[model samples]
Target: MDTYHKFAAFADLDVERFKHFQEEREALSTLKAVEIDTDADTRLTALTADVKAFKTANDNDIKQLKQQINASTKTYQRLSPFYEQRIALLDQSEAVIVQDDDLYDEITRTKTTQLNADRLDDWRNRTMVLHHQLNKAHEQAKLKEEAERAREKALIRRRVALQQRRQQASLKRQRINETKAYRDRFDNLVVRVRNRVDTLDFKVIDAPIEVINAAEAVAAQAFIFTTLKHTDSFTTLQKSLRDTDAKKIATQVQKAATSLWQQLERLPDNQDKVEVLTKINERFDHVPAITIDGATLTQTVTEHLQKTKNAIQAHEQAQTRRYSSPRPF
Candidate 1:
């Protein structure tokens, strides 16, 4: 009966140990669904090591207990269920450990995949930003090149315009010089003609016919010049030449009137003188009215002729009275 009570106490002790192992396995199983972190990984490793230690210890204890149970067939038969229970608890513990290990491995793989995906996204974003910057730089460079080309074209155009302006200015200066030379030559010719006209003697009666012809020739030449240019200077030269010709004509009329008066004074008979004077007056009638020194030459000739006629008549009357009065002898 004492041996029976000892075996019963051992069986109760083994049952309590089995209950403790089940509680430990239940705790390990709870870790299977824990949130993954450094602390969780450490806890899983510690739990896995603890489970291995417990399993090894349980295996040794079971081996020793089996040896002790085989030494007594009665103890073996009585503790068989407890041995099976321990084996089942070890198997359940191993399964729990395997589940926790799988959970940890899955969590680790998921974290590594997420890290690789984040790296890829970062690389792509950086590449896109770099590409955008390169494109912007290229566009700016293109714009700068276009602006430079435009400026170069503008500069070239300005240079061409400046060259053309310079050419035009040079041509204008040359034309002005040519015009001035022409004007100078014309002025010199006019001056020489005026000098020649100034030297003529138009007031003298016996002014040589050759001189008169020369004067006329000079006036014709001056007229030709006037027709060519027709400036104020040429107009003045023409007027001077005309005045010279008029003065020469007036001198000729005065000389003719003086010669007629001399011929009438030399006549012996009044009738002869009358006839001569009548012929002279008839000839003078055809003469043109000409002015000399502000008086008309035809009017002066008429007054002189009238005075000569009166003197001749008076002399004739005196001669007649002498012949009619008793001879002074």
Candidate 2:
């Protein structure tokens, strides 16, 4: 520390010691919220204030300590030489200072002495109180920390719930897109089948090969769920929460549509594709499987995405039009 601060600390050691001398050592750190106030009052009024300050409690309480072992008396006696030093520094009063002979020889020792005595006590009392306040501050800080921990925990749980909701939303989106792709391919296959039956040259194409190599194109959309790692802490009164969105998806599904447009694409157009497909059509509820080899399901997926976006936007707009309520809390 700097010189002034060091001396100030030395002068204020009583209060510092009091804080450190608390019943609970741990509470000392908590109560550190108390501000350090080192400003002293003017000598005259200050002395009088110290004698009565405890009765008039404001931010800092009055320090009223029973004089123990006459320490002040002993201190004043030892420091009396300093008073003489001050007296020596003052030259005899000249005619310029005093016109009257009687007054010229006189010194206001009584008033000065009383002022000094009172002022001395004021300093002692203030120091005692400063230490007392530091202790109180530490206690208060501990309580504040407890409250903060509780708030932090609640906030973490809220964030986790929001994250889970987003993951669920993303999962649903992937499922819908894949389903749509299958439908689109099925539709295309249906169109080709009708055309081929009408033509005289009847022939079959390999299922997987036809789907991927078809004149029509299909897209692969990737997306999935994740579990995060170590980011949480607990305190005496509560705990801290932490989370990160920096992980990769752990799963995927491939959607391929064939040359025939299998709304269902379940059966590749191989040797037994006709019978297998016939049974599939008889077994399933939807024709997207039969009519289109997975309908160019691309358009369907794009539509679903657009619809979701539109619905979200519509909801936002609706929300904008409505008035919100105040929280009961």
User: Mind giving the per-residue lDDT tens digits that candidate 1 earns over 1-329?
Assistant: 44456567767866886686677656656665555668767766776786688678767766766666566676555556545543443354433323345432432344321333344344335445555666688899999999999999999999999998999998777666655654565567657654554443322323334433432343434333443434334334444453554455345444544444444344454454444445433433433333434544335445545666787789878889898989756
User: Scored by Cα lDDT, where does model 1 land?
Assistant: 0.52
TM-score of 2: 0.25
Worst 10 residues of 1 by lDDT: 199-208
lDDT of candidate 2?
A: 0.39
Model 2 misplacement above 4 A:
1-112, 115-126, 194-329
Candidate 1 clash pair list: none
How accurate locally is residue 327 in candidate 1, as Cα lDDT from 0 to 100? 70
lDDT for residue 231 in candidate 2, whole number 0-100: 17
TM-score of every prediction relative to native = 0.27, 0.25
> What residue runs in model 1 are displaced by over 4 Å at the alpha carbon?
1-127, 195-329
The CA lDDT of each predicted structure is 0.52, 0.39
